[model samples]
Target: MTDRDSVFLRALGDAASRLRPEVHEYVAGPPAGSRSGVGRGVFEIAGSPYRRIAGLLRIVSGPDVALDAYERDVPFEIVNRLAADGSRPRLDAERSFRFRRGPRRFVDTLQVGRIPGTLVNTPGTDGRVELLLECSVTADGNLMMQSRAARVRIGRRRIRLPKLVSVKVTVIDGWSPEHEHRTVDVSVRNPVLGTVLRYRGWFPYEYVPS
Candidate 1:
């Protein structure tokens, strides 16, 4: 698909072209030699410190949603698919994290938002929550994105969450010459609870056979 047909491109607008080559390839897919993009990585630090908060998140987001006992050097697998859904372009992914307790997965889908220059992120096994994110490509070619507005769907109705329950997520993605891999860091915070979850890691990615 062309850049115009990419979910990330639509969200970053003109800035999409400025993203680092590696991040751009991951975001704007059907990567060159393969049918899909796959990455295997290890998270230097993973999981939330608050046990109660982690458990509650898992229950509300569905069982497969990301939650685990705090651990270091946690291995994970990521598979990303970018394709046109009828007239819309969407990005879908599933990241499996290997934890001591068990293997847990975080699944998500991203699509162009109704408002231009934005993207909608739906995360979780059931995708009960939807977030509107604003993204940019920095001068150094890194990708920076944040989301503050979120809504939760219940049956046929959707409720816009207030600050107390809503979360602010900040994500950064870029290439790491020092590590000779791609690196990413994500922070999910709440206004009242401070930093609830955070993770950072590096990975060597490739366009693998679908």
Candidate 2:
């Protein structure tokens, strides 16, 4: 990774740490159905806290690192525009984003002009999965910021796993200065492993031992 990339990644990491609460607060509001002045519903009362806690964990622990690292490869022009004159840069928009697992692709649209978050998927020994969702934000009256929780899904696998599996992430758009890869120490029981085999520009290939 270039020095520029490193700087961008660090900046993004810092920004993510600060944006956690804003993302959580935005996600905590009631969905479209609950505002009709209907009688107090079980979901309205019981589900509100659950949603709040879940959003908190998600914001606190989600995939901020990877996303920030990816952003480092973006062109300086875009970065400057995104950063503007602010102390921290926010995600202006997420376009052509796709998460891939083998031949399968999970396609989704991440709304524009929102704080970025992180999502880490680790497999467990009992065949379940752990997902750490995190967000970042700046604290009140402080230059520094901290990451907080929006939600945590323990022992839940949204996608089923094969005996032999690997994770592949691709950034179709946007830019950052740093190479988008990291060496992670995964458990022996984990079906997948993260390794760096090759890199170009700002993206790194995470090789999984076959």
Candidate 3:
């Protein structure tokens, strides 16, 4: 990657970290809905089966994380404007995907309870197929995640896909020197899947007071 790309990724990484609610600030109990304490963004996707798979993941992920309403109330237009450029083409809109933080790492899980209306073949019965991803941040603030242990679980059956999957995400937030908005740039891939999902876009999101 070029120096410009590296700088861009680091900026995006900061945005990603700022978007998550501080675990210490949790209100109480479990979240009421995906909207509570969650961030939301709209992304443009690419690829074939992976693009379709990403769409499925979006519907189940819900809103982004927002622990504090005041701090997380960034407008979608801001993010949208930040992503507006001629570098990449927009394919589809992925809205309201949420990320939750844990004690050790951050997690984004997609709970697929029903099949998508657009999909022809159903993957399973009425059971839920969840896509659980765990991520950790490097000291430099670039977000990193590996799919080596990622799972696609259908009810009680856990299926760990074969292949090494990894991603480095960066987020540009309000404090950015160049831009004062929040946006995300993510590159995710598996050896077998190649570029599973690569998107750069922005969306409107808010925090639900716990």
Candidate 4:
């Protein structure tokens, strides 16, 4: 691993160390090539682990503008407005996040549902299992959504699902607080993964992986 990779690994290890012991079990390596040219590293926290807590922590300690490319991957501006004015916008619950990063346009919608407050590893019909989460928005407009820290046994089975991942929003509106939300969306293929903004309009986005 290069120096940059070492720093990213250390960050991931440090973040994992701060979580509950059980939550650590579900933590996995950041997907191969998940780290783009602009990001320092990409890390993945399983949905099982995410449903345990209500906040997300984006480790952005290395390079400046390390997460610039990821802003288009999440729905930050809309969430910030809701948390700031205490006004709940008419969430489509079906509307997906749509944004542009360079020449690419990414879009994905989550199937929202109230998950029962129960712990069980049930197989999903679409091959993607749903997990409950207590999502919390921070004052700075960053989302810190975590999962219930518990051990889930998969019994040697491999599954593919779009897990809720963290995005760091940069432009916090004046009405927003200083704390950022470790926000996550259900889409996982976007090359950008941590950029955050304060508006819904398109902007020139770029990232240089450290």
Whole-model Cα lDDT per candidate? 0.79, 0.24, 0.31, 0.24
Q: What lDDT would candidate 3 get against the real structure?
A: 0.31
Best by lDDT: 1
Per-residue lDDT over 1-210 for candidate 3, one digit per residue giving the tens place of the 0 to 100 score: 122221123223334343233211221112333223344454343222343354454343322311111112222221111121255211112233322221111123222112221111111222222233233444544343332233444457756544453222222222122443334555545565565444455533444444
7 Cα displacement, candidate 3 (Å)? 27
lDDT of 4 at 167: 30
RMSD of each candidate? 2.2, 19.2, 16.2, 19.1
lDDT of 2 by residue, 1-210 (tens): 122221123334545333233232222222332211111101100011122243332343343211211211222111101212244322221112121211111111111123444433232122133333232333431122122221224445254334344223322111222432211111112134432111123222211122
TM-scores for every predicted model: 0.90, 0.18, 0.37, 0.21
Candidate 3 contains a number of clashing pairs equal to 15
Worst 10 residues of 4 by lDDT: 76-85
Q: Where does candidate 4 stray beyond 4 Å?
A: 1-101, 116-132, 137-143, 147-210
Instruction: Give the winner by TM-score.
Output: 1
State the RMSD for candidate 3.
16.2
Q: What is the lDDT of residue 129 in candidate 4?
A: 32
TM-score of 3: 0.37
* Candidate 4 positional error at 103, Å: 2.4
Q: Which ten residues in a row have the lowest lDDT in candidate 1?
A: 1-10
